[model samples]
Target: MSEKTGTFVVTHAESESAVVRDVETAQVHTLASNPGLEVHDVLEATVAPEPPLEVTWEVIDVGDRRSIELVDSDLEPTQHEKDLAADAEVGDLQQEERAGTGEIHVFCVPEDEVEAAATDVLEDEETVARAARLEAVRVEVRRAPDAGVLSVRYLPD
Candidate 1:
């Protein structure tokens, strides 16, 4: 005995495209667009059926579930932050080890999302400094987590 799969028909909008027929029942199939209406015309007025809208997306392959990037935003680093960063001291062994392993990623999210963190970090600093440098980017705003923030990675070139 053979199992039979169900036959189906589907129609979307005033689609000039569709498939409607049963393979087992050989019958005449008709593709009739509204009387005398052209493809574009069927999709235009308040009378004809709606058309399927098309949307496009750009694909990206970021290395990891990684840090946020500030690409085209109006954000900029602050002068006070510059002074503070300049005054920042070197990290001890634990800090140095984190830098060496590439584990910590920093992000500067929108001002509204920064929680119990020091307001000075985001308010004074425009760019979210990361253990790794940003290579490729999407036009978006992302924030980093609460961790020992590093002003700069003093790792030698």
Candidate 2:
């Protein structure tokens, strides 16, 4: 068997296997699960062209931790928002305003909880009403293992 090396973005993950998208070729590859792997983490893998294309991946780098951006807000996050964010396992909440565009950024979120957390934060009664009035509320969540460097962006619509 021959060896191939490439960078891949994990697209799907389960206990036994995962589907990864090759960064250079844009082709999908499957590999035995690396417990450390998470969706959206870019990694380098050594693959053997066996019958099923066996692969082993190592996380050489990590993506940015910032997740969830709230756009076009005039007011600061209320106590309710803070409480919700904290309960959702978010850390380092920062707000920024530039050219009438308001954005809220957060870090240190768990990959598995990104969608649920974002939904809970954005779907709150007050947040829902505010988002509806704005006509466009964008939230992005990036999750990773807190103990290691594996990172994945799980954005909820």
Candidate 3:
């Protein structure tokens, strides 16, 4: 009996069963029971294959479960981030861990589409999940309009 532990996103859920996909491995697992999961819920869990055919899985343990919030940040990008944006080439992306906690993602987009790109990050679940990763509670989108620069900050609390 082997168990896999990772961050999983609930892709589908029903009264009797549910499906989750591992964020890192992209492997899909069908659970033997619903476990009260809901669509888009992110979970830190351990799963093991069910008995018999072992085609389905069971949640052996759950370390954490959370839903992330995405909002347009009123705050402006930091001066240092602005400098990075100015120096980065178009379509360039820079990812760095926050000094304290969480993560920072910086992107250089087309000047005209910076707003649209930011909105996409706000509305796209997968995009937000990819940015937020593990233990992120909220995601903030800060855009430098006309500078073709955008920043997505993932916060732990």
Best by lDDT: 3
Q: How do the residues 1-157 of candidate 1 rate in per-residue lDDT, one tens digit apiece?
A: 1112222121121444432222233221233332222211111111112223212111111122222232322333333333343444323212222333322223333334433233443332222222122222222222222322222222212
Per-residue CA lDDT of candidate 2, range 43-84, in tens?
A: 555654434534554332343211123333323334433443
Structural similarity to truth (TM-score) of each candidate: 0.18, 0.34, 0.80
lDDT of 1: 0.26
Q: How far is candidate 2 from the true structure (C-alpha RMSD, Å)?
A: 14.6
Task: List candidate 2 segments past 4 Å from native.
Answer: 51-157
- What are the lDDT scores of the predictions, listed in order? 0.26, 0.43, 0.83
Candidate 2: residue 115 Cα off by (Å)? 16
Better of 1 and 2 by lDDT: 2
**Which sequence of candidate numbers ranks them by lDDT, best first?**
3, 2, 1
lDDT of 3 by residue, 1-157 (tens): 5789999888789999999888887789999999899877788999999989899999989998887677799777788788878778999988878877888888999989999999988877576457436467778899888788899888887
